[model samples]
Target: MRTDGGAAAVELTVHDEPCRDAAEVIDDGLGTANEAAAPMHEVRALQCYVRSADGQVLGGAVGRTWGLCAELQQLWVAPTHRGQGLGTRLVRAFEQRAIERGCRLGYLETFSFQAPVLYRALGYEVAATIEGYAPGIAKHLMTRVLGGS
Candidate 1:
């Protein structure tokens, strides 16, 4: 580490091991930030899975409720199941579950090349857009009103 014109320019080294366990640190940071944002509330994971006749998981959504919103962390379907409305069904079911858990809105982040159209068709509106993620790649943050909110 050295200083240039009184401005410190610190050298760095990459380590295979973490300085501390990341998960616990992240949880602690989240707890602190969430506490500052609002009174601590119980966060419930909401999900919906579609299975085959033999009970193989085919597609689903996973999300959790924070405050009054459902965070849509992931939604996916087997390639063989695409274009058949399974994605729609999964999203609908997830939103319904979020509603039951007292969430008044659904929030999700998606890449521009992904299912932006599908989410829009499901009544999600773009809350923010970031361009130039990598050339033509972009990121979209979307939200949908749930439970009449």
Candidate 2:
């Protein structure tokens, strides 16, 4: 291939030797095996809830997760039911899941559109603050400590 009227070249090579042995493979695989056995270090999804008794869809919380920490990606509650404590309930529910996962610390970032005050009142401390995260939106980095399971 040629680009911008310049000569172009490409090269490819393949190695013939085996890249890893039994011990190396075992070492690499051990981390996953150990985590599975421990259970707390396992990564998992965030849960959602609805008003089952009334068949009303309330809201949902989504999480982006690492081995032991989960980041709340999105939280939405229907406007008609805003002041009845649904957000607090959802947060507590997510916290339970985090505790079960043996997470010592949970971190999340909220843009200008998010509910920063709610999180702050729930014992989540502001770890870092970023100005203008998205045009007029400030980003708040929050963290909560979860006791080991």
Candidate 3:
């Protein structure tokens, strides 16, 4: 890429896989800009997992909390564990931790064929939706008030 004057050039490299260094750089840059814009810009990881008595991992919920909001990045339950309510438990646990961390709102993205119904049962409402995310599927951006806040 060249500047308007064509005196300077910049190179852009794309990676097939995740680049930790690039991620750190992006995080640092965003953190700095966000902190400059707001007082509550600190981000923290929040995760919840379910394990069996034999120590086998069953389900998990991964997310982050920043300011007054919590974002549920991913949630998964083992095929054999589906319909057992482990998903609900994991979500509740994740939300409980978020509430403890002072997050009054919860947000997450789910596919139409994924856990949108479950999230709705857990009090999440669709804030936005993108149709044809893949094939016949849709992407839903959901949100809910945590701890009645």
Candidate 4:
């Protein structure tokens, strides 16, 4: 393809599965641009996990922190571990780490079928809601201040 009055050529490809190379290229390009816009934009992964006595994974929280903001990308708990407060613990651990990293706020998206109630109990307030995100479901965007900041 050509663009910008035919001054630049671009190629696009679709993959049937996850493409790490393509993702890396896109991440690199965006990272460079973001760094130019915000010199302090150093993103770092932050994760917390719970394990059973035999070292089996039970629950986890995955997120990233940049500047004063943290984004919770994923949270999961084994079915057997649900209702035992493991999810709450994982979230607390994740938030504590972000606080240690100097993050003042955190945000995440959760589906109606997911742990929106749990998040609310942990002080996350819904900032936005998307109706019909899935069949009979809604998506909620939530945010909270960490460490009273």
Candidate 5:
């Protein structure tokens, strides 16, 4: 390895048991996260992947549930596939699964340049907004009460 800065500022080593070491580190990290999050909610993770008719991978939704709330961590649709309702379907399917898991509310945060309006049309209300979240951007946190009567 090479750097323009001081080599003494960095220390590099190789682990003979890379997999075992990584597994332990992952476990420890999850333990730390769960210690803070588990008590407040039931840990449930979910994902939904979209595929083309001929089996090309597109985009999808991935999120998790905590307590009675579910969050949409990520939602993406291929640029060529956008404006075709794929994003909406993915979100609806994800929320349906969250509902099945007993989540009563659905929430997500997106940049101001993203689909906050689409979410609003789907009944999500703005919960919060952070200005200048990214120089010329803002982050909008939105939430909606889920479940049926």
Candidate 6:
């Protein structure tokens, strides 16, 4: 996902059914109400992928932006595929995509059940912490500057 002040390009090396299905289901759930009321789609989404050398899917990340700020909506690496630098690679890829779209900053929220540590290590700083964002989960709001380096 490295950029050289040029147009953004996405490398979708893999596409698995589970992830695509989940995204469709979630989007359907959220978009139903909006569709009934507005009859339009107003949001754009992005998906970045990482693949093994032999063409197997390693992992990927997903995100979206409204304007100058982008929200990293979700990132997932298969349990057996973790710790192979896929997450970091996907992040760098998405960052490049966001920066190319004129994004200046990026942010993401992770719960205690997820990897806030990974986010921190990826140069995202804790912007806010919610004691109980979910029933038993602590939520960390993290942010990073895009194209700063």
Compose the digit string of candidate 4's lDDT tens values, residues 33-122: 887888644789999999999999998999999999999999999998899999989999999999999999999999999889999999
For model 3, residues 1-149, the per-residue Cα lDDT tens digits are: 43344666667677899999989999999988988887754789999999999999999999999988999999999999999999999999999999999999999999999999999999999999999666899999999999972
Q: Which residue pairs clash within candidate 4?
A: none
Candidate 1 lDDT, 49-127, residue by residue in tens? 9999999999999988877789988999999999999999999889888888788989999999888999999999999
Which of 2 and 3 is the better model by lDDT? 3
Preferred candidate (TM-score higher): 3 or 5 = 3
lDDT of 1 at 147: 69
Question: RMSD in angstroms, all models?
Answer: 4.2, 10.4, 3.1, 3.2, 7.5, 16.2
lDDT scores for all predictions?
0.88, 0.75, 0.92, 0.91, 0.86, 0.83
Q: After superposition, how far is residue 148 of candidate 4 from its true place, in Å?
A: 4.0
Q: Is candidate 3 or candidate 4 better by lDDT?
A: 3
Work out candidate 3's RMSD over C-alphas.
3.1
Instruction: List the candidate 6 regions with Cα displacement exceeding 4 Å.
Output: 1-42, 53-56, 133-136
Error of 2 at 122 (Å): 0.5
**Under the 3 Å rule for N, CA and C atoms, how many clashes does model 2 have?**
0
Better of 4 and 6 by lDDT: 4
Model 5 bad stretches (over 4 Å): 1-30
Better of 1 and 2 by TM-score: 1
lDDT of model 3, residue 119: 97
Model 2 spans with C-alpha error above 4 angstroms? 1-42, 52-54, 133-136
Candidate 5 residue-pair clash tally: 0
Q: Name model 3 segments beyond 4 Å from true.
A: 1-6, 9-41
Alpha-carbon runs more than 4 Å astray in model 4: 1-27
Clashes of each: 0, 0, 0, 0, 0, 1
